[model samples]
Target: MSQIFENLPVKVAELPELTPTDLQPIDKRYLKVLLIMQSIIFTLLTIGGAAIVYFSPDIEPTLLHFAYACAPTLVLWGLSAALTLKGFKKKKYALRERDLLYTKGLIWSVRTSIPFNRIQHAEVKQGPLDRIFKLHSIKIYTAGGSQSDLSIPGLPEETALRIKEFVLGKTAEDGAIE
Candidate 1:
């Protein structure tokens, strides 16, 4: 006996679209967390630059020299802060019946969707900064890797836990989890 395989073509135009507006935005406080982290990093960079200029044998420790040494750090920090503020609005996520979706970016947008059947496990994590901000992040892992396939950050602690439980339940229902 012989079996024949049939392949059907899908109509691309008939598929439903996932628009940015359809997704829910992350917590607004995440922006504050990001700005604080950026400020801390830039402060350290500025201090290091100042020290280098002050101690250098070749360079005179003048106000002009200090300004020149720290100028690049200040400029870069300003640019980074601006981009972080602008890009924060672009981060959004959605939990659909069949899959989880996360989208983020300003200039280069990216959207990731993972179906329930492919999800092996989910976890909610909070760092020191996240704890201070009362925020949590959810990480979803699929098969074949120790690293999570997708991580959605800047969520309330309760929301993150709820999402993690939902994903785990879905995975179990789909027989992805034993």
Candidate 2:
């Protein structure tokens, strides 16, 4: 029993030795698609605000009143749009020998790494806007809490599939008999 315990191997899971500088940025078309989507939503919201000012019976249609109502939305929209555009530039991901690394954000940056050995599954997702831009996102799920999972967006469809396959292969390889 003592000999068996002494011979047992130990495995330590460390984050992949990769840095933000080593990561590759996402496709440029993603930024354009996001801008278009935001523009459409902005248009709708502006129209809705205008309708509220025009149709309300009790409130007078003063320019100042309209400005007060619309100003905050416009400001928030502008800030959000600007941050989205800048955020995409910083978004990046990479597949390493042991895990996948993803980094993204504008003001508050975040970096996440999911080990291939611990991954339970990989999924590729695309929304209407993503379809229009030929983009896909890969979601990697692990055994732990929901926060441990990683979602990498703005990948080209082909790239997303390639990454998905690679992760699946790694998972299988880890489970195979030596």
Candidate 3:
């Protein structure tokens, strides 16, 4: 029998930039919240499952079963958190003259390059918890995504204002991306 293999598309790597990131580290506390929330969900699911399997007599009970069930979530969440944090470490998410690059990811990192010419509008947002944390999210609008608005969380109020001014200025200057 002849062996057959399919070639997969490969993404080329980008060269390291000499510049630095504009924003501060996207506080690891966010990751903590995510992990904690996921673990809580896992716990709740387990509780629900326990309620169902309370009187089951068909399947054998083994530590392996529980481990196998939770292993995928643990591994996936662990890897994802690790990578996202790592990307935060290496790259700076900031706005440039031509594009607004919001880069975040690990092995499969993403840098959404929103050219100023594409900007339609910009906004600043804050929430209850944000007031407590003195943080806000600067939302940028383009015509690409649903509302063309993207929000980056965990920014200080001042920083969010700065981003808004910057985006608005760029939009006025370019006047093409819309």
Candidate 4:
């Protein structure tokens, strides 16, 4: 049997909106983790710069000269730390019955949504820093892609696992997987 294809136009005003207030914030400890990681990177850069200045016979190895050479790195590290702190508040996620949403960014905010049926797999990941802070991240991969469609980080270990299971279950119920 062949049926006629109907193209219907819908009213945009009647659609539901995802309020920012409803979004859940990531773990607070993630900020501390980020700051520590930034400091480690800054220290490495400073060490490398100092080594270059000390090894090079052409350049005079003075405390003032080393500080001058590292000024740019210092400025960059400071800006990054400040932005990380401000941007931490912007990282939030919400799981709806039909889809998952993640919002992030400070100046150029972005929100991404992935429907449950499109989800192929979900997994929980914890890096060395995340383990130290007892934090985990959930990576969701959808159909037509080898990369994860969404990654929500700074969640508690148990929370990340539970979310992953819930997403997988939803996909199964939708007949997205065998």
Q: Estimate each model's TM-score.
A: 0.88, 0.83, 0.61, 0.88
Report the C-alpha lDDT of model 4 over 45-126, residue by residue, as the tens digit: 9788888898989889998889987888899999999999999999999888788999999989999998888888898998
Clashing pairs in 4: none
- Compute the lDDT of residue 43 as modeled in candidate 4: 85
Better of 2 and 3 by lDDT: 2
User: lDDT winner among the candidates?
Assistant: 1
Q: All candidates: CA RMSD in angstroms?
A: 5.1, 5.8, 9.4, 4.9
- The runs of at least 3 residues in candidate 3 whose Cα sits more than 4 Å from the true structure, single-residue gaps closed, are 1-18, 21-24, 55-91, 126-132, 144-149, 176-178
Among residues 3 or more apart in sequence or in different chains, the pairs in candidate 1 whose N, CA or C atoms overlap within 3 Å are none
lDDT, candidate 1, 93-143, per-residue tens = 998887899999998998889988888778898878898999999999889
Model 3's alpha-carbon lDDT is 0.63
Give me the runs in candidate 4 sitting further than 4 Å from their true place. 1-9, 146-148, 175-178
lDDT by residue for model 2 (99-123), tens = 7899888899998887787889999
- Which model, 1 or 3, shows the larger lDDT? 1
